[model samples]
Target: MENVTLSEIKRTPELLKQVESVPFKLEKGKRYLFVGCGSSYNLGYIAAEMLNKNGYEADVVTGGKIVALGDFPEADVAFFISRTGESTETVLAAKALKKRGIYTISIVCAKDAELSKTCEENIELPFADEESVVMTGSFSTILYMILRGIKRYSIDGIEGFLGKSFEYVDRLELKKFSHFVFLGFDELYGLAKESALKVQEMALQWVEFHEPLDYRHGPKATLTEKTLVVMYSKDTAYEVELAKELKQMGAGVVYIGKEGDIEIPYQDGFETPVRILPVQYLAYKKAVSLGLNPDKPKNLTKSVKL
Candidate 1:
């Protein structure tokens, strides 16, 4: 029932400094492909969005999609992200890209893993590796590394944020909520998606993710006392109002903004990774409350070999 995921989450700020000096070279003016599964795929989605928005050309695709349907974007280089580096689809996808003369790079938490061995080059962050079936700190660490490599972001003061998020979660009773919904826009939308996955993976909770205003369209029909809607606000007036409105409607709301529940300073999109910390803590706490083991979720493995 014990695992390194919790320890790794607590060590995020220290982990960031360890990889800060790594010579990661993401060439500009070239098309790049980012591929992975689950949290890894979501990180790729965020990275690709950030890179494309900041003077680079990048595309994101899932390893399963590439393996099952052979649908992948053409690119000069492919970066395969896998925490365990042994996911069958990711390793197979790397092999497929390398066969096409595309430069392949593996970003993994462990060295000499199948995906790393299959790719032409690799960047391994063994310090970020996890012992749990679910991803926590490794998700943020690899994401920070990718964003830093692309020269789109640099992070600071996250150590304080890490402590604050843990404290916030410690004070709350997470068992009250039976369902979780996360909302954001653009890069935050990617984060919203990741947040939903975190609860679903670590807590086995019902979860949904959507764009901010879109929830009012049809998703609001499901609002109830058992639901907790988390708004990763851009600090816009409309987003702020929506959080207030949701709270009034009986659904518990967690508004994360410059001055909200979690009190995160919005820095363009750089805060996106850190914005996930509270939700990660929330999920873990919720799992513990439900008498479930966050480290070993049912019906899941550390790596999806098939």
Candidate 2:
């Protein structure tokens, strides 16, 4: 039986095609804020980074932070992201933003979700909804939707990239490593974080995420032969050197960049939505190898309420 998680991941390219026609656009000169929890939070974080890099001012805050602090950043508009849209903090955060006269928009994969009701407006993509407990396709679909506002950039040869990436990861000996480290910068940093979460959630492995250079500061002390480092590089000389250093430390390394072990050219972070495809597959493959089900992650529910 094909895993539901794998099915969702594979369907992302088609989801992107569907979402591409959805007429999503962001206004210029308006401060934007994004709020969500878990994978949704990571999606917002990546969106915030991409927009800010492309001459748009944006900020991101976890729903829990806004609900706890009762203080949010100044923004002309706020976007609340939730797959199921019933996440307690996210829905509450949307309400709080609405009370402050900030326009709120819910970006959800489900129709008529609680978050959509709490916000001033909603952008629902029910077509991308998933049946698995962990988020897979929707993350990239929403991220691509947000990026499309900046520029309608299609991932050229997406299907080919997906197949090659899955094959590369599948070739690895999953049982050889138990520790996973993901490294990147800016929006890629958000991608690295999401990648780490996939491994932890699906494979139940120890995973960590850090900015590439920051790893040398102190994080490298824990490197072991059992560690597998995944670097999302910008193809910078320093980053390429860092990959070599980590490999020398007995950590298995998979570099993803212009000239990486699994070459996926960087597109100024806009490629992030596509870049995540392999790690998602890696997590699923790891889970299956360990006799675990990626669809139903242990001790987790689809929507975290309260």
Candidate 3:
């Protein structure tokens, strides 16, 4: 019900600091695991990608799957992402990992949540608590924090990328799209997934996500003049070809990133921190236009009880 833009805007610095403070030394051959539920699960996906991109071996799994599988690699560290820090499956997975003597970390909005209390480290997000049933700003802010945090610690040229991304968000007319699709490859897979989730949670739209090469598959059958396809151009040769194909399908296509003919100035290299902004803006603007409070999506609370 309140303005979330300010909070989302202010979160970058704090996120950078939180990421810097974490002790990252890992034993040789040890793995890293990221776990969460729902939007938090999406965060885990992003975190895992960031970690992998930074030369760490990391994998993402839903908290429920972690509990059911009962077997994980001997992780040197595990991260649990929960906005409220109290997701049932995340808490249980954290507890299970702790019992194995692994270092557990929590990225959460609630500083004093049970998950935070149980983990060895807690990174509290700057986004305000969401009162709606669906997650909007909370999901984006936390993910932005995670990406920014990774950029601060591992990647170079992140701040410039973040600034450019913010500027790009200011320019987008996000609510104009009636239907959406996100396409990407490699690490961009996480970005596309998060982008699709943002539309779904904040705007209540089921945005489709696909691998760039796979778009030619059966899924392309749904393409129409009304469809908006947002593709991440990760400096790949296939991007231009894929964009061309999608355009031929009679869908409006917006290509993101550098190294593409349809250049999006806000996107930079594959590692640029600003890459997340367009989708974030898309979610925010769509929420504003729909008269639905992005700060609170319907049927969504800060946390799931179980």
Candidate 4:
């Protein structure tokens, strides 16, 4: 399991190159609905926020919501994303949307999988397929590929950023923190959610996620020496102040932004994919600290059949 997860992580840069060649195109001025389950849904949320910012109308919905309640939103086209392509809920959602006459697109890591077969259009990412229960590189790879298809996103200094991220991650005392909080907004909010999931899935740790300023509303009461607050900052003054206050209050804080721990450039949400590395490393390290195998993760399967 360790090899599976780490293998995917180490191959991300090369995976991005392969994902860029995926044959898919977005029509300008057309509304899009993105549906998926779990991490895939979070990626859709990030994509919706980004596309909306760039003058496109995009809405995100989870496949579970669609399957359980028929809560699909209105849009000119619907895109379904599933890493394994066999997720029942996602495939069902795509089939239902297509039946309603909405043009449907499927993005999966496997070619000729059930989900892809159910859609009118399929953007299969065979190269980004993973064997681990949790997603490491595929999440970032798929997101980057979709973004590149919309407008080229260059990860020019990815190697340097990754090295710095690991350095910061290694220095963190993982077992000291009993709780974790991830803060961000918009696209970063989706990223924050995904980061929290990684820690939960990989380390079985108590994790929370929220918009930066919103963290103070009620969640701040939980802060302590045992809590780790990871701020995916937008380089805003208020967030910097919040991070300072959290640090003074005894919580371990790792701020990711320009001049922060991870020090990623705030480029209109273009750096969202890079923001994931530090937290991913933290999860892996925390799992190891607890003497748990991150690869197997309690009771998880590579793909949810039902």
lDDT of the candidates, in the order given: 0.87, 0.93, 0.69, 0.88
List RMSD in Å for every model shown: 1.5, 0.8, 4.0, 1.2
**TM-score, per-candidate, Cα-based:** 0.96, 0.99, 0.79, 0.97
Residue 283 lDDT (model 4): 89
**Which residue pairs of candidate 4 clash?**
none
Q: Where's the lowest-lDDT run of ten residues in candidate 3?
A: 261-270
> Candidate 2: where are CA atoms >4 Å away?
none
The weakest ten consecutive residues by lDDT in model 4 span 1-10
Better of 1 and 2 by TM-score: 2
lDDT of 1 by residue, 209-304 (tens): 999999999999999999899999989999988898999999988888898878898887776767888888888888878888888888999999
Cα displacement (angstroms), candidate 3, residue 162, comes to 6.8
RMSD of 1: 1.5
Candidate closer to the true structure by TM-score (higher is better), 2 or 3: 2
lDDT of 2 by residue, 1-306 (tens): 888999999999899889888988987899999999999999999999999999999999999999999988999999999999999999999988899999999999999898888888889999999999999899999999999999887888889889999889989987999999999999999999999999999999999999999999998888999999999999999999999988988899999999788888888888888999989999999999999999999999999987
| lDDT digits (tens) for residues 212-303 of candidate 3 | 88988788887887788888877566877888888887887777766432344433332423465556667767777888777677777667
Query: How many clashing pairs per prediction, in order?
Result: 0, 0, 6, 0
lDDT of 4: 0.88
